[model samples]
Target: MKIVELKNISKRFGTILANDDITLSIEQNKIHCIIGENGAGKSTLMKILFGIYKQDQGEIYIRGERVNFRNSHDAINLKIGMLHQHFMLIEDFTILENVILGAELSKGYKLDFEKSRVTITELIRKYDLDLNPDELVYKLSISEKQKVELLKLLYRNSEILILDEPTAVLTPIELKGFFKILNNFKAEGKTIILITHKLNEVKEISDKVSVLRKGKLVYETDKEKIDISELSRLIIGDIEDIPVRNKIDNGQALFKDYITVKNLSLIENGIIKLNNLNFALKKHSVFGICGVEGNGQNELIEVLIGLNKKFKGEIYPEKLVPAIVPDDRTKKGMIGEMSISENYFLREKNLRFAFKNILKNIELKFIKRFDISVPYSGCKVKYLSGGNQQKAIVAREIMLNHNILIFSHPTRGVDLRARDIIHNEIISERNKGKAIILISSDLDELLSLSDELAIIYKGTFLKVFLFSELKEKLESDRTSLLENIGELMMGVVK
Candidate 1:
């Protein structure tokens, strides 16, 4: 039976028709997956359903009855809950406090703390969730925070749940655990609406799939009838392969020993996050670090970029300037409220060229070179699309007069066109004799760009492989290589 249905839904925002004549139905107790590229109107439709945005025209039916939601509160009361891509939990509060914040039980004008705590503890044990009720939200890991959000919805007795990009930050093991929880929810007669751009995930867990393209419902099918290649075509409108860069040899090692990091160790929350990690980057060489997410990738990046100062490490070439494009752009990379031109100035250096400051001309040249796609240089970075914003950041970082570059998940959340531009930029920098450290969760990206690869797990370096030998080595020892790397990432072996 269809638990939710939308007919002739239309929404407009100024010059953009965010959603045009879209219609869809979601079955009860089934996983409905929505797949689309960025700016494809997927978020708008989901926002309307969650009552965060009102549809300019359309009719919505919930369980065979027509209904309209004025706000998120109304939707929640009607048993609908949404877990956003960015979690919304207070960092200072404990897990139980965050879960029962807005909806608290009271008795005779007094807060019933004991009753709520008992109920929350019972729910945690019932669901087999490994979480401490008294643990502060700030102390929990990303996966743990996600589980807290889920518990919030369950605590409210929500019948229908909407998860947006739920597994983007989870490790492979955590992902498996999450899928098990989702299956349990379905078995208990709860409906799920999953919004994602990952095609492999859709094929794995979805029962029904819907594809949205350019603000319209382009196609819909059951899981049995869809494949990854077909979904890619529908979403991107083409199946062109990305261009691979030709390998080039660096002559005479222009600064062979550019930067060296020795005995790097970082401690956070009374735990050793990075322990005696050591590596060297050669001039004009790409050093790739590939591992499961959250296995010290973030901490390593933080220490390198000077964000985490509480670390013991001998950083050679400390006086040499470096540019970095961080993984979480929204949090660390760009100033959202600043204009494109203003942001470009963040990395500008004063050059004594004929006693004149020529930073303005340099900024203009970069703006044009990167094809930032903004109306004008004065446009705020926050108003630009995700891809354009990313381009602006890349332009700013690469244009800086630096000898070393650090890129962390440089192509994440970027579309195909933007990704190509980024790859080309990386190659251009490499050819210019700049040492680079590339850290990413995408193994495909690591293999394509790295001259040498290293696997880091639990704040320790497991092994390093040279690209020249990878092909021959993999042919002879595929099982051992994959198993050792996998086991190290999971902390099964050192």
Candidate 2:
């Protein structure tokens, strides 16, 4: 059954046509994906469907019945729910309160808490979501917070769920578990509309894929026709091969360690966060760390960046100048209220003389080099979308030319085209003799860029191999390395 359908949807902002006569269909109980480069009308079209944005011209149908939505509440009342890329829960509220804030049960105008609590508890247990109803949202992990969002949708009894970048914050293992939940939803005949940049997930889970390019529907196909290369080409029209790191000139050249950790460990809340971690990276290569989240990746990055000093063992070059693209860019990477130029010139001592001129120079240089589309350089960063904000941050950090770059989930929430651009820049940095430590759950990305690969499990390095040593073996059988590395992450050393 065609559960949802859009006919000739068109939207405009100022003189910009965000969506140009777009049309698509989403089937009943199927995982339908909408993919595109940034500003390719995916979000705009979804917003129109959710009633966040009204299309200037279009017809929407639900269950073969024509309908119009004036606001999100109308869509919500129609059993539609949306999960945004950035979580939308208030940190100060408890899980139950957050879930049932607007849709509260009442007896004689007084608040009815007991009934809602029981209902939410049942939903949590049914979904195998290990979360406490009494717990505040502030203290929960990224994965747990995401579960709360899911619970909210269930609380409202939404059958058509729209998810935006749903797995951006999840670990490799958490992602697998989440997909199982989605599968269960499918089995139960619930429809899912997923918006994601991860093409592999689209291939693995989506029943159908609809790709958009520059506000137009460029391609549409079912999973049976899914191809990674074809999907990439459809998303961006073209793409380059995965980057292979270049080995240094001298065969016997001493690759000095820019950052070295020996027997590093951290105990938090009577739990060993990291257990005797050890790794070394040369000055001119990318060292990729592949691990399930919460296995001490954050602590290790903290140690390297000097954010957390209470740990056992040594991180040499104690005073480190590291440029980091953090996982939670909004929280840790850059200040949102600050202007792009302000973010660029922040903490610079040399710009005191002719500060305005220097700031303009920096802003113009970054905009030209990184393809940052901004109304004006003086605009605050918060107003930009997730992808644009990320690009601006990447531009600032990379342009700084720091010798050591710590890219934590470098291309987490960006589009396919943006992912390619960032990958190219990371390779460019490596070629310039700047060492990089890439921590990501994306295996293909790691394989594409790493000179050395490290598989981390349970706060320990289960295996680490230089790409050169495994080159011949990987060439003989490509799937062998993926299988071995995947098993290692699962705590099985096959």
What is the C-alpha lDDT profile of model 2 across 77-98, one tens digit per residue? Answer: 8888888868889999999999
Candidate 1 lDDT score relative to the true structure: 0.78
lDDT of 1 by residue, 1-494 (tens): 99989898998865567789999999999999987766677767888888999999999898888989899888887788899766789999999899988866421335566887888898787776789999999878778899999999888888999998777666566777888888888887999999876678889999999998767999999989978888888887874665656657664244467778999999888887887988888888889887776668888877776777889978886655678887767778889898765676665755335211344465467666764555344566775655567777878888884778988878765555556667878877887788888987666566667777888877777777765565555668766766665666666765
Error of 1 at 305 (Å): 2.8
